[model samples]
Target: MPTPDLLTGELTLTGRITTASNATFLGTIGELVVVYKPRAGESPLWDFPSGTLAHREAAAYKVSEVFGWNIVPHTWLRDGPLGEGMVQAWQEEDPSQNPVDLVPAEAVPGSDWKQVLRGQGEDGQMVALVHEDSAALRRMAVFDVVVNNADRKGNHILAMTEGHRHGVDHGLTFHHEHKLRTVLWGWIGDALNADELEGIDRVREGLQGQLGQQLADLLSAEEVEALALRCDRLRSDGQFPAPSGQAPAVPWPLF
Candidate 1:
């Protein structure tokens, strides 16, 4: 839960999120900025699914700790213009980073295509995709795959000038299926390195313990099974497993 002071809405009204959702860019509350995602009225693909948006955000934040990426922000349970919502940390936007635009691995110097792909602007213009460190980014991507991140678009990655790429918008994560899709596809078939394998081991160990207990609150039984399947594949193959069945790679537009 977020502290009362962080939950207060005032100066933030001056700003808003450019995304399609009913999101508002709440002013920075500490090291993090807050965003409000109100429930959608009536969408075609999905209809708020009844009552799980905030909880979905909560579960993703918790699962993020296990993955080692800081995508989920500290959410304060509060009422929003739409209804109850989560107040998330604001990620500082930097122009140096490319927005989900695919960059060729060869064009970027010193970047190993096998390990990870560094993002560059479409016209061969140089832009920071995920810092110079491809190793760290690959690990996070693997974690995302393990969680079955339904969305991992390139724009979701916010590259800071100081050499860190932060991910945002995780309200639709942790579902129990092969619903993985996103722009971070640099490591589609590359095998997981040692440290990467070790991290999966940690998550597997945690799943049956306190983590599983916690996931229970946010995931359904089928979803939990999906998570298990992903981990099992990673552990067995040491590489990203192929898609099991034919599933739409992307979500509906309104979502």
Candidate 2:
């Protein structure tokens, strides 16, 4: 399906994603599967303004596009069965691979994975939260930081069959305040490579032009300003940031 069709085609809701904090649906535009989150269905959040999560989701996609890394799936705002909402193309993740995972602490891969932390599992076994040390996931970590994503849980990172990684469920992002909670804290102080720095530079440049204009429409003026500041700070620091603030650095129920 073409972009126009996905934007204007009739949305048919197939089912509800009961696990989502806000009302989320699995739906279709003709033959193309998509995920929808209606504005009216958004639950009131203490920190975020009401009825704006959908807009934040779309804003995240715009920032992702500016980064020139396909960190987020294609997302946009459109009128749907319930009401106006955010819709994103559905991704069929590769089941054979686990990009972010919780494994027995002693069993964490010594080579390919970066362990974030160690904790006790429900079954009383010691487990470790870990994610891949690949370039794809690292890009996603940077993307999450740029967006100030407050809920980059394990399930939100999708591993594709061809090694691509897509981060989803971005409604909890772009807050004016520092709220960078995520499971991708493996590279806390690692220096960002040239390509990563280049991506940050692109975002900084975009904020001076079209990307800034687009975000102004989706986020509050303060939020947009904060987004630009984050890009600048990241570029200036030249390394992955250590988690800061009074709130938890990582989201609960990690998966």
Candidate 3:
């Protein structure tokens, strides 16, 4: 791990993350590979407070740690070449494993896969958007719900060689509203397993103590209350929630 001063050292941009809504860069601090998203480069959004996306990214990492599920990679906030931004460890996804795939509609049947939705592919063939029903992916879905993640695009999931799945690009989170939008809704309406419910319980307990205090440093008071409320709702409901029916359930350009 790079120390704060080392991470704040000169950032040499290796490449730009063009698909991001805001300006993002792939850079390195000495031998460590990192992704940097400067606050100055953030495009303002009407719903979220201005210029705090980088902070939210770091907060999401904290929440991931709270759950003891390594769904999110190590992240921090520091000054970079552009401005203050979120810096995260770079994950090299397995070249052979695709996290999300468009398989033929008729070709999907295995219990190991969860079909998220069906649509027509560019080739005019009926296809199903599917992801592996692995424990890592399931943990990520739970993390999304806890944070009220507004955008969980398919490509945000990284598949590592040993089958570990890491979620990235969590800037659109911690909203005080029901802004849960994502492609990982395969477990909709499913009952929460005992372990999953226990995780939620731990989060609820943390909100009244250390986790809540840490979140206060990165999020607004209202957002912190909303976070606690989400834990309450999930605990009471005891299931993965379905779409609220008030907003789009999934993000556009799913990939």
Candidate 4:
């Protein structure tokens, strides 16, 4: 069988992801599965301008690509059955491993995982949120920081086979003001690894070339400049940053 042409192949809506604030559809391009977020289906958000979420999603994919990290699955803007939207290749996550998990506080394991924080569950039981201490997740955390991702919920981190991690739902990103919220705060203040710092450097360089030109089509001038500033700041710090803005540190419904 030939590879499915995601752009031109017919899109069949498989299901609706109703939990999403905006209308999200599970779609298929021949045998290839994908998630489609149409611009027309997007709900209004006070912080972000309306009808631009799809472009933001595509911009996140471009950033991930420039960093040479397959953090976000292959995504692009296209005219789909629903309308013009961002379509991303679907990632079937490994059920056994989760990048972020909430375990009983007392039961938190000592090895392989880093404890993020402790909190009470709805049942009034103590729970400790933890994330795998691996290079994949650290890369994703860096990606989020650069994008200023404001809604990095736990479930958005997809643990794929062979330890690959993919981040999704990046519509709320690249705002001029600080708006970084995420569950991947376990590495705060940690020294940036050589590879991570190199990725940041590559992105900074790309911002002056094709990456910057492409982003100019998707984001505002101020937003693009802010992205460059984030890259500079992260490079200068040489470490994972602590939450600085007044915005909430994590998104609600921790997953």
Candidate 5:
């Protein structure tokens, strides 16, 4: 089958994703499946301006494209059945593979996974939050830092069948302030490798060209500047930063 044109196709709603905080819908454009979140359906957030969540989602995808890491799926803003919204190609993840997971505290894998923290489970058993230790996930962590992602829950990391990891639900990104809450703290304090530094350099360079102009349409001037500053800071430090804010380092409900 030919690939559907996401930009100009007619989006038809199939169903709602009720678990999402915003009014998200499962949709289709011809034979292509996608997820849609309308600007009108966005819930009010105190820190973020109302009705801009969809724009932020698109901005995240733009940055991901600059990195060439494929951290986020193809995302863009378009008019859907509900109205103007953010539409992204739906990714079918491997059910058996979990890049991020909660396992028994003692049973955490030593070599393959990096343990984030240990906490009590709902049943009062001790559990540890862990994620795969791999180059793909490390790139995602760097991407999250540069975007100032406020929420990077375990569920947001999709483990694809071919071992590629994709991140989703990036509405809480690119704030001017330092609101980088995430579960990918496994590489904290580790020096960024050459490839990671190259990716950051690409973003830094893009900010002075087309990427900066693209973000200007989706985010405020201050937010875009902050993104540039983040890229510069990460390149300067050459290491994964530790959480450094009064707010919680990780999001509530880690999963």
Candidate 6:
């Protein structure tokens, strides 16, 4: 989920992110990455697939609960200067190094909540000073596969200095297709770890009980099925199962 800048109370766009799918800006309401929704008079025109976007993002939060991972921040649908938008709690980092900058564990210089772990990324990819030891990064990798995230770019995973790896930009997830793109390629083809397996087990057990009912409110029938399928596969595999999709690999420009 993208957040509104805090400094401005609302995100006021000073510039445009022409290259993005949603209307993006270089402005600051508080933390950076203020995503402005396309207003009625805007160039892109406001025909936002709001229902789908919100559904997916909210579902991310819901399914994350299955693993006991904090996949969601404070997100609410609100109107900003741009129009209807989703306001998210902001994570700290400079977006300038987005897409391919690496935050070595040493780069984080203060007391913070996230930690930077060395993860595999493509060559020439930009890296940022993600807050360093991600508490649930490995868990996040598993989540990405289940959701089939198509935009797991470098910027999406924020590693705070103290080690909480936060996964963001979940708008492109749950397409009912297998298009998993991301910067956490370091774990490609790797098997699930013991803790990760435990998390999956927890989710699997919960799916038939409380978590499934909770997800019913947040996800579509298909989405819920997909979630169940992913969980089932993990339980059966006892490992990070192989990529079962038709694509050669995950897409480019993870963000």
Candidate 4 has an lDDT of: 0.91
Best by lDDT: 5
lDDT-based ranking:
5, 2, 4, 3, 1, 6
Instruction: Show where candidate 4 strays beyond 4 Å.
Output: 1-4
Off by over 4 Å in 5: 1-4
Global Cα RMSD, each model? 5.0, 1.3, 1.6, 2.1, 1.9, 7.6
Error at 122, model 2, angstroms: 1.1
* Overall local distance difference test of candidate 6: 0.59
lDDT of each: 0.61, 0.93, 0.89, 0.91, 0.94, 0.59
Error of 3 at 191 (Å): 1.5
Name every residue pair that clashes in candidate 3: none
Lowest lDDT sum, 10 consecutive residues, model 1, at: 39-48
> In model 6, how large is the Cα lDDT of residue 34?
44
**Candidate 3 residue-wise lDDT, 1-255, digit = tens:** 347656667777899989788999999888888999999999989999999999999999888888888888999988888878999999999978976777899998599889999989999999998888877887788889999999998889999999899999999999999999888988989888887888888888888898888889999999989998998999899889989958898888887
Model 5, range 1-255, lDDT digits (tens) per residue? 123467778899999999899999999998889999999999999999999999999999999999999999999998887789999999999999989999999899989899999999999999999999999999999999999999999999999999999999999999999999999999999999999999999999999999999999999999999999999999999999999979999998887
lDDT (Cα, 0-100) at 92 in candidate 1: 72
Q: Is candidate 3 or candidate 4 better by lDDT?
A: 4
lDDT at residue 13 of model 2 (Cα atoms): 95
Per-residue CA lDDT of candidate 4, range 2-85, in tens?
A: 244666788899999989889999998888899999999999999999999999999999999989988999998888887999
Question: Which residue segments of model 6 deviate by more than 4 Å?
Answer: 1-19, 24-51, 78-84, 94-135
| Model 1: lDDT of residue 140 | 59
lDDT of 1 by residue, 1-255 (tens): 456665665324336656645354555444455676654522233622555656666677776677665545465456655566666776677887553443455444344433223444658765433323366467657767787777666666677777566666666677665577654555556788887888788778778887788878777867777777778888898886554467655343312
CA deviation > 4 Å runs, candidate 3: 5-7
Q: How many Å off is the CA of 222 in candidate 5? A: 0.2
Q: Identify the runs in model 2 with alpha carbons over 4 angstroms from their true place.
A: none
Cα lDDT for residue 106, candidate 6: 44
